[model samples]
Target: MAARRPVDDTTPHGTTPHGTGYGALLRTPHAWTFLLPALVARLPYAMLSLGIVLLVHDTTGSYGLAGAVAAAAAVSQALVGPQTGRLADRHGQAAVLVPTVVVHACAVAALIVLAHSGAPDWTLFLAAAPAGAAVPQVGAMVRARWVHRLAERPALLNTAFAFESVTDEFTFVIGPMLATGTATLVNPSAGLAAEAALTLLGGLAFAARRDTAPAPTGPAAPGVRRASALASPGVRLLAVAFLGLGTVFGTLQVSITAFAEDAGSGGLSGLVYGLFATGSMVAGVLYGLVPWRSSARRRMVVCYALLVLGCSTLWAMPNLAALTVAGLFCGLAIAPTLITGFTLVETLVAAGAKTEAFTWLTGSIGLGLALGSTAAGQLIDRSGAPLGFTVALAGSGLGLVALVTMRRLLLAPAPAHRTVARGGAVREEAAPAARRG
Candidate 1:
């Protein structure tokens, strides 16, 4: 067995301290209860893109049509995902997830039936939209639960966020493999069917973990209103940054596939891409162990800068061997950046809007993926496989520029708590350190 690392209680700024390590964080009451189900509920997200592509491609025999159908789902999901989160924040996660999971199951089932029946392409898009839109914001809700569970304990919150990112990386890496292999090996519809099955089962189970859910937001006093998470400039900035990461994700998927096919090793694409997630998971585990002094906002900037530098090397990688190694190095910055961004967002929004804020960041990534994949696909067709990487690099460059230029906007200015009292008058109180993360 590995030796236990001692927790330092004297460390300032929630860096390294008592029970902040991964082992300790997992030991939190009922941690596995909520986390395992949340992880299962979220695995479908990783499978959906490839699952859709496979299921649709098989039925239509037109990759272009299949892609368009998938894109519609992705775009609608991006637009509607945050709204589910907003509702969850107000009504509690169970209230939102129960109904959302039902809707998602029906929508996905309808989509599968429509495709298999040779239904018109428009009908497929119609089913796809709702199917995508109803995807539970389980990941965001999980983070909100962590925030609530670890409140007044920032170090553990940091560890929890890092662990979340690591799991996300793991899911994405594994989800596609499960989806694709199941589709090809069993039947085209099997992957999507399995995805729906997992979501239904896991989402309901997660919803039942109400004890860990955040307190629902109650009605504001008459003549007073709560702020939407998007109203915060910092939240918007982070959303755009996540969008940048999404673009990189989209670009890489297509570019790697194309590169592998060109090299007569298409079968190796998944394993090659898996390397990227491997690097991210490794970095995320290590990230949670260190005790950093800088604010999450500063860490976001630095990690993103590293991301941009990493992306710069992708376009010039000469072969699969070099690209695979470069991909690993480039991915090293991703989880750290993602973990820092989530930590920062936790500080930027109010308790009532935290889930919404997290959803916006996640939804932005979905939108970015759609945009990036579309652009990269066209570029790859017109030029070559290597050109697809340019989209990833460009997205990173633009996002870095935006991040650096608007770094000030990334800080949280809203008071940590708001009081509505005495004839609906509201008073705001700031907890600067807590708000700064």
Candidate 2:
């Protein structure tokens, strides 16, 4: 398919003939219409994850089993992400999202029953699998819409992604606290039910928006699969970066929990995670505000350097307080890296493949986190929490290495253009940096 040209926003009614750019992008009737669901959908994920260990422990009376159940859900999501994305692409996001929400609701209901009914461990695991499979692709779909709406405004697009990443940190921080606290106060099973209700509400809210729909694609020619959207080299490299980052995130979460247990302050794990999230949230807002004349590649290199320094500090810290400080530093880099990388991917990917590309990206993150979290859990069990932290730091280093090696292939120049002003005047303005993988 031919590349879609950016729409000129200078037109007299603030919209272009091709219907592209920031003005057109934000022209939708309700901006929060998209943001609300995106924000709400995060609640279920946060609650489900935070409550998983507690619920499973209550049901099975095994920490090992609880951790395993968590891993099972992560793996299931990873396995199905691409398939689900493909379906969303072939049909539409609603076709996949609506049904998935129902499945998720049913699955949540079943798991609650299984947890309460003294069901066998195997049955509980089996019942949980389908629910994991039903998670809606809200993150992916919202991003796809961003691409579709902001096709002409790359900078705004980048800022939007940065906002999304920040929101994710905020959601996780609050979601887990709410989930764990509610479960402790009310009942473990109630947490899961609450997540079910949130998922339905958030997923439906996002689906209800016209802007949230997938962009129209080129008619499928012979021998084309919907998954082909993510086949580009740029998207694939972004996926690799996502995989590395996801592993780092996943391993860090498990290690922090283990560390809390080892320090005889298991109760403080959620608090520390909250601190980490707070730091990231603060950094995210600042990231958008910082003025930088350098290229995105430069920004990426700087961000990675900060991340490496922060991750390495974990090994140097000797106490929980120091570790929390280190986590804060590391957290600060999370949104910047993700925002820059995803924005770059959005620019490079084919217009028609936006949803699929994002799905692959999201899937890479889910898979990496799954593998990292599970592996970290096992390592923590065997060696200890510090060793797990060391392992996590090593993963971050590897990600930095990967980013450096691929730097040349990944950094595409930002688009620049000169325009002829009316009355025979001439003017030149640089387009937002052209994103390339």
Candidate 3:
């Protein structure tokens, strides 16, 4: 049966509707047209950090320089992403994506050229900035489209958010393998080159599928009180929490590598990382399946507390096997925390600002990862791998503090406004962000 788009905005934040599965979300018309390309575009994001590190390291032969270049790009992306999302809201996604994709491809080419030419280190920063900035926010845009499609069906939206998080973790698990494998089997530059190619092709394909894109929301009307997505207190809180979440990711990658190397099992780093992602993937699938009674506001705090608890043991693990087990435990809390955060987003901001709001969280993660990696590297250089794990634990602990103290912010009402469909048609109703499950 085809999924119906009724007015279910009154439904609470948790997944309460029993029969709506991810299949139901996909069974509708034109779903695959936009979805597959979005997934394709997003894969490069997971690849870029590693790919850039590999290529730059090959050229510079200095891990410090290579990591610095990658960090510059990630920070550049984090700063520019929400701006792109806001522009997409004012104009159409396709209008913004065409130029963004073109710039991204050119920038990547320039970065590769600079690295191979042994240009001054400053030159790499120049190319890396725009390459990261112009990388399209396909993941956030796709989520906005999902909001436009299922604004009335909150249960299905819950499943959709869960599915997207799982897809993200899937890419994270696969992207590093593809990048490192290509560099090993082919050439160092090949990994980043493949990443650029995917962005160019998949971004264009996604942009061309304009029929499914969220309609351009030109400006907020007089009745709409919010001036920006970040104006919402809840949105800001989630962004902060997600920034902490990113540190876990950034810290783990470097720390795990150090751990494995210390134990004479350096080859197992990828396997350990994959094990962590697998735990999140399994948890995400199960999270979407269960119908819950708690509101999303309460859920965020609980899930984050669990994440913090899981991270507390990372600094104390005695060996590679123990560290991997600790990572797996920490991973189990990740997807659920992310799923709840995005769900809260759907209810926290008005339709006009959906994409921008989502980008804020996504970009925060990027920022956290860059900062966390730098911090962990410094700590490990001064001390050891065990000290490096403290970065993840400390970051998450700070977020938990906010989650517990300022959770009332999560209950702020979702600003009221209907989503404008293509050709200026209104397609949704006002929704309250602070509702019970």
After superposition on all C-alphas, the RMSD of every candidate to the true structure, in Å, is 6.9, 7.0, 6.9
Please give, for residues 316-356, the per-residue lDDT of candidate 2 as tens digits. Answer: 66788988988887888877887767766665555666677
lDDT, model 3:
0.81
Give candidate 1 regions above 4 Å deviation. 1-19, 60-64, 414-437
Report the lDDT tens digits of candidate 1 across residue range 1-437: 12323222223233454567888798888889999999899989877766776687679764445556766777788899998898888888999999999999999999999999999989999998998899899999999998888776767888888899999999878877788678767987988999999999999999999999988885566766667788878888998899899888877766776687689985566677778878888999899898776667778889999988998988899999999999999989999999988887777666788899999989988887777766776677678788888998899888888899998876554333444456777664433322210
Superposition error at 309 for model 1 (Å): 2.3
Q: State residue 138's C-alpha deviation in candidate 3, in Å.
A: 1.0
Per-residue lDDT tens digits for candidate 3, residues 335-378, read 99999899887777767788998999999888887777778766
The regions of model 2 sitting more than 4 angstroms off are 1-29, 61-63, 116-118, 222-227, 315-317, 411-437
Off by over 4 Å in 3: 1-16, 219-226, 261-267, 414-437
What lDDT would candidate 2 get against the real structure? Answer: 0.69
lDDT per model vs. reference: 0.81, 0.69, 0.81
